[model samples]
Target: MTFQKISILFACLFALNTFSQFQVDADVRARFEYRHGFGNLFPDNTDPAAFVTQRTRLNVNYKLEKLTVLMSFQDVSTWGDTKQLAIGDNNNSFSMFQGWVQYAFAPTWAVKLGRQVISYDNQRIFGGLDWAMQGRFHDAALLKYKNKNFIADFGFAFSQESQRNENTDFLLQGAFTYKSMQYAYLKKTYNKGLVSFLFLNTGFQDFTDANNTIVDGVNYRQTTGTFFKFPINTINFEGNAYYQSGKATATKDLSAYNLALEAIYKPNNTVFGLGFEVLSGTDQNGSSKNKSFFPLYGTNHKFNGFMDYFYVGNHANNVGLNDLYAKAVFKTGEKSTLLTKVHYFAANNTLINNADTYLGTELDLVYSKNLLKDVSMNIGYSHMFASNSMSLIKSGRSNNNTNNWAWVQLIVKPTLFSNSK
Candidate 1:
């Protein structure tokens, strides 16, 4: 059957259930963005100028007693002289990003089935990928339970490949969380603080040619991490560490690790934060390899300072990274706020023997305002500067030192209803 038929069938089924505990909610968002590149920063630049694009999202959720269903659809388009050159035609049209059903078996036990999002502790190993206009969703089943201060979760993902691979894969993950703030030294006084541990395993199944022959060996990856949050006065300390070992579909086995630390100080409407991260890389096991790292649960757009040059999962393996980030937020009034951020990133390993490894710097600014009681709008801009050692920005044999890029985005959101207990 077609997707529309399936959707209509589900809706009819829900309508037939005579339950007073049923509830429905919906949300929609629209965004317009403009991007410009200069000095050979982006590939295939005939005029090398600016462009505009638009995106719209609609989400519907239905709940009946302990069962909940969710679906999201998005539409994307571009315009202007450089629209085709900058945004590409592949992004045009509408698509479903997620569809899932969740069942709750008491306050502490729940299971989500169907195409859902599998986000775990710190998102170092698994995430929903919500930064993009059309975010990532998983086709999987997840089970979760929480008893008092302890929580456990497990998930299984099947029949898919990520942007970097061609093989269908499966993912298994387990995570645990301890919510007693008094047990950890850093979290003793913070009632809402938590400590979590996660383990993720990904394996490829039947990754072979159409003739039922194996072209590359089955791939496997294991990731383990611990994350904690501590609050002191108006400042909060957050940290995470992860170790990963994996072999790509056609590559040798590799091992890597990551470390992240941040301090967020929020005193009323104004907030200031700073963070540092490191990814380790060395010649281990007789292979000159690069260490892997995930930015974890942090908002990629907010942390990497909007230029989206690194840590967005675009350039993952070739270079290790060390990043320093800072942000400041100011409340302009009761209904408006202004935010700005800066990021400095450098390569942890040498791109070449003689080349320096400083990656680039980024600057971002955003303004948000509440236009009405339940309506809001946001505007943002970002700029990036490329260094001589940044291989991703290089063209031919010359380092594109003059390369730079900028983006602007506007968003509008209106809420329908909210319930408070």
Candidate 2:
């Protein structure tokens, strides 16, 4: 069915259930961003220019006793450009992001069907792709069960056809989590600290294009990870490690591993955080050539420095990174805070091994404040310094070696109704 028809149906459903044994909630967000760079350093190197983009999202959630339904739609477009295409259009006009339904058979058992986001275990093996302008969604079915700190999940997808691909491919995955300790950390004092184990398996079906050429065989991918959070004194410490095996676009078996550690200290209105991460690279003999790390469930903005050079997932393998990050936050007033972050990244592998290494450093500054009740604003700036071997230098490309960008954002949230227990 068309989006318009679906929207109308939802509106009717919501109106008809005003007094039923169900509850409904909605959230809306609008964002605008302006980005300009001084260099044409990457493969898509073009003329240096500036542009603004806007994003609007609507989220609707309905819960009836143990059953739930979720729907979200997002529109993205460049400002002041009638002829310009959407920011990241693989093909379609406004993307139909997520539409799903979930049903619970028992208090601890449930199943979900339809297009939705599949995020599990630190988001290394699976994630919602929230960084993109339109983000990413998958068509699949998921089953979940949780009881007394034990959780198990199973998921399967029959297709991976983005708007660009007319043919459909299949994928499947499964994961499990167990809570080992109760009240092991400050954040979980009421429930205890928990240990989690996760496993995922995915496969894609072989299909030919309209040209009748054999596309490829069904590729298999797998991931496993463990996570723990514990408190030391007034500080909280969290760490995770994961390993992944899969076939990349080249059909070559790829192997990768990642390790992350984070410490957060919170005292009254002040907060401080430190993090360290290491990613393994593929061996030279083409053995386990997929030396790329999976970020899993991290707040991408909080890691990889402020420049967002690494998390963009552009030159993944070429930009071997050993990153160290630190941040400090202070509440200036009742409704304002100042945050500063610094990142230092150096080449993990030999510079001579790959030419893409331009060891880099990034600095970020942000200030956030409440303008009024339910209204907030944020201002941020980032600066990146590229090393000699970095891709930012090309004669035909924009000559600016240093990259600088800034943005200002405003948000308004109004609640229709809320209940507290």
Candidate 3:
């Protein structure tokens, strides 16, 4: 809450370690938002939701010749929501955000173990969801390889509710959750552009049988994709294509894909972007199988407009989406920048009930400025204009009211301790 308290906390963390190379850092973010139409559509009668959220983090790193270790603790909460709880209570409403260790056996091979975040090229399928108050992390193991122009990484994980308990049969905590997962990513850099390939496999736990009896089964899906980026003169081009197959949780056949391309031009201090993206949709009238593409664990908010009107969890197996958008960023000064984006959204497939393909349009505006060496401020506003098809998709959900959102956020990351020597 104050600089003195933060310093004391850092000192306490340092007291626990006696390493040759150690560093401690602190990160704090506070955001106030007014959501007339946040994640969901608003009804005409219901009032908009408004709140302030904050995240505080402290991280420590210790490195040696053969091993490297990191530990980060975080607290995420809404403003004025904890008045009923006592401080330091064992209620223990906290997270050990990240705890991991990496060991290098050779120059090109290393393994990292523990709970950490996974982010990849374009973050189209896997990402660190930093926008959320409690960010995303995975308990897994990763094997890494690095070289001059090539790199490869493989990750494996299995989620379970009880560990080392013989009575439990390795059951994952929640329904529709992955019981086990694995992925392999490889990348190669070329003279003109860089290309990367990814292969991810996920298995979900089965909980029921034909007779509605409890059972343990496995349903699996695999995702494969490639991402590329290159530069031509002042214009930079980028694109990606991904496909998914295998069976879904219900053992239904699954087939899906996503394709996107973008070109960015930066001349002087101003930048411009043009992009198009499409996700395949299921054919409701034709088959009993599912075909809608899910981005899996990617940062969906970065796409489909910041308003998060599409695929943020609302349209998983329904009609897919098509997005055509453009944006411009103007660097106002050395420390300030402004960005504006416009998007046109449509359904990827014709609706079985109504042949409507038109979804809606959205506009987003953002401004950011640095106030101190370690502090920055950001403000944003977004509005979505829904169509009749949107009403049909959101059927009985949204309040048929105006949809808009506004927010202001501040980020502070400070290096509490470091030994440059």
Candidate 4:
């Protein structure tokens, strides 16, 4: 079946090129950041860090009657990190960011394969993670079906280290990467509301025993969730609920959950909103089962404050988070906007030695403006007012230290070539 699909796709591609559409585009983004306590509490007597990073990408897309193909190449690097007169780069930061092909066999059915991005809904479970200089991609295959107001997608992925004639032992290492993954997503759309359901199963290679010996097997984990959005007049409400279970390791049993709700009111050119979220956590003392909830592949930096103090490559399998936030957005000019948000943070589980649960409060401000048709700029600042309890989990640093971060970013995207144009 796979061979037949590929053959049909190529045949269509060759026959329809004369009447097909092809396009080329580019994206360039540069960001400068000043970090005093970006991801953690600032310790006393430590100098703040400043740096600039950039991501440049070239994208090619081709579309025929029933087939489509896309390829993207990108280079991500930091300024002042390479030698001016070097013959070549040692880091090899250039890579194929995405290469995918899709073929629609029926009016409402299609199959897509290759390296691609899997993001849906609010991105609380899976996301593209475009904020990172090196964005995320998955090598997988998907089967999609869609009708008037209903859609369904089934995805599968498997990984291996290399071709070996002897055994199927995968030693490829990563903190959150899975050896195998399968998922199903379904969505229903109404007049002004939508609801979606997702079920994902991920398997990890288990290679170590209790005594640190070699074992060959796989441990599986499961995540199930639902997301919904509804609008009533000028107020919109959105929420999500998710649960995680199964084995996190060879010997550990997992049990965790996440819940969130938000309401937004957009009257005229101004917007206001309020939100609350909870992620289950393990007890500080100890427990027979694990309870900490991790968002896995979500765009976590977009949540829990832009400062990324939680769930951005840190804070896993520990005390979970409870966040209550309020935000407002104002149109400052014809092409400019300003946003302000405040978050009150706390713990979802009991703290060690009966410590306080109140972690800290954060304030974030962002200003954005469009300079040209394809150019835009953004400036942001965030401050964390830490409490004594926050010091307990964040390296025991002094809460009195000034904890703040600031950044500026510029983005430009242009269409280099288009057949239709």
lDDT of 1 by residue, 281-362 (tens): 4421234443655443334543454666655544455466788988899999889988888879787665655466687777
lDDT of 4 by residue, 1-421 (tens): 1345446545644554464687778899999999999899998889999999999887778888898888887889999777888765557777778999999999999999999999999988989999998888899999999999999999999987787788666676665789899999999999999999999999988876544337578899999999999997888999999999998777899999999999999989999999999999888888889899999988888899988889998888888999999999999999999999999999999888979999999999999999999999999999999999998778788899999999999999998767841
- For each candidate, the alpha-carbon lDDT, in order, equals 0.60, 0.60, 0.83, 0.89
Worst 10 residues of 1 by lDDT: 178-187
Ranking under TM-score, best-scoring first?
4, 3, 2, 1
Superposed Cα deviation of residue 320, candidate 3 (Å):
0.9
- The better candidate by lDDT, 1 or 4, is 4
* Cα RMSD for predicted model 2: 6.8
**Better model by TM-score, 2 or 3?**
3
Candidate 2 structure lDDT: 0.60
Error at 195, model 3, angstroms: 0.6
> Which candidate should be chosen as best, given TM-score against the real structure?
4
TM-score of 1: 0.76
Off by over 4 Å in 1: 1-18, 21-26, 38-46, 49-52, 79-92, 120-124, 160-190, 205-214, 249-251, 281-286, 294-299, 392-412, 415-421
Model 2, span 1-421: residue lDDT tens: 3457568857855663553343333333344443444222433454445565555555655566776776666666666645455344433445557889899998888988887876654554456656445665667777777776677777665543244455443322211111110111111122546667766565544435544245556666566677777788889888777777775433467677778888999988899999988776543224436666545333354467655666444335543467888989999888899998888776555555545543567788889999887777878887766565554323334324447777776665554443322
Q: How much is 185 displaced in model 2, in angstroms?
A: 21
Q: What is the lDDT of residue 386 in candidate 1?
A: 62
TM-score of each: 0.76, 0.77, 0.92, 0.93
Error of 2 at 115 (Å): 2.1
